[model samples]
Target chain A: MLHVFGHLNPDTDAITSAVVYAGLLTRQGVEARAFRLGEPNFETAYVLRELGVELPPLLPELPAGAAVALVDHNESAQSVENLAELRVLRVVDHHKLGDLTTASPPYLRFEPVGCTGTLLLKLHREAGLSIEQQDAALMLSAILSDTLHFRSPTTTGEDRDAVDFLAPVAGIKNVEAYALAMFAAKSDLGDTPAETLLRMDYKAFPFGDPAAPQLWGIGVIETTNPGYVFRRQGELLAAMDHVKAEDGLSGVLLSVVDILNETNHTLVLGATEAKVLREAFGVETQAQLANLGHLISRKKQIVPTLERYFAPDA
Target chain B: MLHVFGHLNPDTDAITSAVVYAGLLTRQGVEARAFRLGEPNFETAYVLRELGVELPPLLPELPAGAAVALVDHNESAQSVENLAELRVLRVVDHHKLGDLTTASPPYLRFEPVGCTGTLLLKLHREAGLSIEQQDAALMLSAILSDTLHFRSPTTTGEDRDAVDFLAPVAGIKNVEAYALAMFAAKSDLGDTPAETLLRMDYKAFPFGDPAAPQLWGIGVIETTNPGYVFRRQGELLAAMDHVKAEDGLSGVLLSVVDILNETNHTLVLGATEAKVLREAFGVETQAQLANLGHLISRKKQIVPTLERYFAPDA
Candidate 1:
């Protein structure tokens, strides 16, 4: 059996992608399953429930010599354990290539679009396979979640086209209203712990050398109102410190995006270096203040900015 | 006009890819010309002269906002000056991607293959275009050059397929003879400065943190017999020092591969640190000698070893 999964922290794209792509792979004649590496976050859980699709079983670690296909991500740091030893049948991602090399060549498709769902939509079409209703809605939700409702700079014409194509198939007449509902579901952190909330959309960047390194983690909190996280800044910062110590993170940052206004406000806690962050964003060091004025998407904006800051010469 | 070029130190793959890809681009109805970032070395010059084709003009720097397509390389260190500011329309490379990101979406095709010439052959076929006689021979020569006459560990089935497909079209019934001629042309470095010979196929790897730094550069010299370069070790070491000082390179290494026997003997000259090579290959720090036992290709055999040595965790 082929086990398909995404990166570690199961976001909407990661979760839905595994499920939707596993369906595609199965239709193409593989006994594949969608496996979640962890529990889905609020947005993914809400969307899966909305689509009436059960979540895949949580897979903490991969078994030895398993045959698998990875969706949404390929980084070993964020992928299944023993990735290099396993047979990676296919990798479909939109992120920068990391150290995930296969023993033999596999089917690999990578594009610089906003979402893996965009690629999925294209792939399903290319394969002459129609997207199922639940997967269509899941695809729509995944695209919206990754692109931040098409406000992200990573949102290409292809993404807009995918949303338009899937939105109707998803039986949604009003995308704006659907996006608002989805964002609201994502916004409601409810009783989730501060560390889990912060880690929900976390991505790490390594600066300097890979060995004896300087590394920082940036976690994003996207909500309709930034005030939800900012109201609990002290608790979140303490939680960020906890994550920092656990992960050996040199710096920890939480980018709280106001989905309604399309603006970003960040809180930073540095265990070591913050020069890259300060230089890249022109933000004051060790400060939890300032609006980045209408920038919400992490892929197109935050990651790129932080990448350049971390490895300017790379 | 679309300006197309390859890496700085013009190898066969770098040079021919520009010419062949430019030919393809032009046939597909774009005004394109192959440009060279630096002067072609002996083999490229010899092959181009034999084919009765003029070398592209030497382009030391790329002007800001120039529309360009890069072939065989995407790293800014090996590409045109001001690559970040320039509009990169397309990138076709077979190497691991370094920090090459564009302001907008561009056509990108990256394959982990033996040669960029191999990629060009596949691309040309996909475009439904036939290779011209000169271009076919150039492509054949390039594949032979980069893969060390198909003996390098990086050589793949696709590369062998490309060679077989192109051999007849290139008017060479004897592929071995053709490869020998090409290798002989490359092997005759004949009075070329040691720095120039080494730089002909040099690829550098940056170690440690990008913010502060430990940097190392590796250069390979593949020949039918290693005696030519090994005989002039002192001059080569002096040239290595010159290159080290000029580039702020931490340590410089020359891997001299005896192509016929498939054995590599390396020379080491370290300005500051030799620990990476020492740790990686389990060699003495400054001993300037070791038989690497039939490891010819830098990409497959040498690079991965060096990368692991540099970053064990990565």
Candidate 2:
């Protein structure tokens, strides 16, 4: 069986891309099963229902030691140690390289794009698969989320090309209208802080050194609403800080987006490394706050910027 | 079975509204089957598939043999002569009143919007039935098409309200993006003249007194590409003129739309009245060929303009 595994704390792109890609694979006579790293959020549920696609069952902790093919997020030895006992066939992602080992070195595809969905789209197009309208719509949604609805600068020609290809297939005359509507629906923040916090996927990363306290990055994506971003900022930062303190983290990074404007108000807590934020964004840090204007998506903006800051000086 | 029928030459609004309204009726213990007057074009197909919806089979020529519920387009005694044998229980449309009669006076819902989808949205929302994401997506598509993606001045607060209510349910963030994509997809002119002509729903309206030559109105809707308006003008006019000559028409009215700009280029072929076009649009006879600019929509703009021109005293 072709086992397709997606990243931890999966987004719409991570889940829908895997699902549609799996559908394409199945159509090609491949026995494929899709697995998600975490439970889906409200937005993902709405999209799946709209397309009449069933959400793949979430596999708790990666099948307790089965073969895995990583998608979207990079695989690490630490993350896959439990699953390492089983065979890993391939890895498809858009993230920077992480230390990963497989018995048989699998086909590793890592392109610098906004999201892994874009890569899957490229694969689908390259393979000449006939994309259905529902799948097209989902892929478009993933691109929008990854590229911040086409407002992010990190969006490339490939991203726009994919959107142009899928727009007609989706039968939507104005994708921006649909994006705005979907984002507006997501702006209602009536849930508790914990619920909101849990609704998002969080990833833990090694900071400076593996033992130098863990660092966590949290991303929240929504359609453009500056007011909503401004309102959620304090609470989100506080929650992350609380989580970090409880878990004993060196630092926690929170990226909340105003998708319409392609802007992200980034919050960094626990670390006095203003240089880290500064080097990442070229903006001088203020007392404790860093406002990365027009930096919307974590996938497209924050991560790459962080990678540059962490890289050796040119 | 509950008969869910929409206007002839069904657009996105007409088809989607029918589906959503049917779903609502079905949930309320009504066995509703959606009926369309003609084949769904590429644009309509995209939406149906994206929402995982299947367009109901075409209703061959109004099913004069079966009970019907007239929708969108108005009906007349001549139009229903075959259906006169079957009872028409209700008339749900968003067009100006048309000559229609039933053995027992049926429920008549004729609002002044561009498409009947708006009424379905109201009914679904008012009924308090849960509108699924696909249903909501379809409903939103209908509204966008009917209202020219909200660019038409004919759009009302009610239309906006329905859009606001349905947008989130569909998980669409930006309605314009969806609309643009759908419209661009439909701009292909690779089809034969007959196919292109048949792609849009057409209706016959006997204009003027019986003594006068019969006048027929034919319209074609494209989500985008106003250039097609000019390109197809001669062919459409010729087709109408041919039909007119064959049927001894006094005049024929044709409208082509650039839905994005909310503009319609119209050609009126007949000697009976250039005055109606002039009176309605404040266009002089000499300026008819000067590109009439944005004419809004056939239902909201042209019809109202014609009414005003025909009845200056009224």
Which structure among the candidates has the greatest lDDT?
1
CAPRI-style class, candidate 1: incorrect
The DockQ of each candidate is 0.08, 0.00
lDDT of 2 by residue, B119-208 (tens): 777666545667788877887888776676778776877788888888888999987788776677555555547434633745565443
lDDT of 1 at A213: 53
How does model 1 score by TM-score?
Answer: 0.68
- lDDT (Cα, tens digit) per residue for candidate 1, span B1-314: 88999898889888998999999999999898889888787778777887788788766466777889898877777777688778787777777655565544456666667888888887787667888888888888889888877788878898899999998888878888867776777788889887888788887666544445456678888787589888988888888889888988878888898888888888877624356555776656445665677777777777667655655344
Q: Highest DockQ, which number?
A: 1
lDDT of each: 0.79, 0.63
Q: Taking the tens digit of each residue's C-alpha lDDT, what string does model 2 give over A111-143?
A: 567667777776676566778888888888888
Model 2 CAPRI rating: incorrect
lDDT of residue B101 for candidate 1? 54
Candidate topping TM-score: 1
Return the TM-score for each candidate structure.
0.68, 0.46
**Candidate 2 versus the native: TM-score?**
0.46
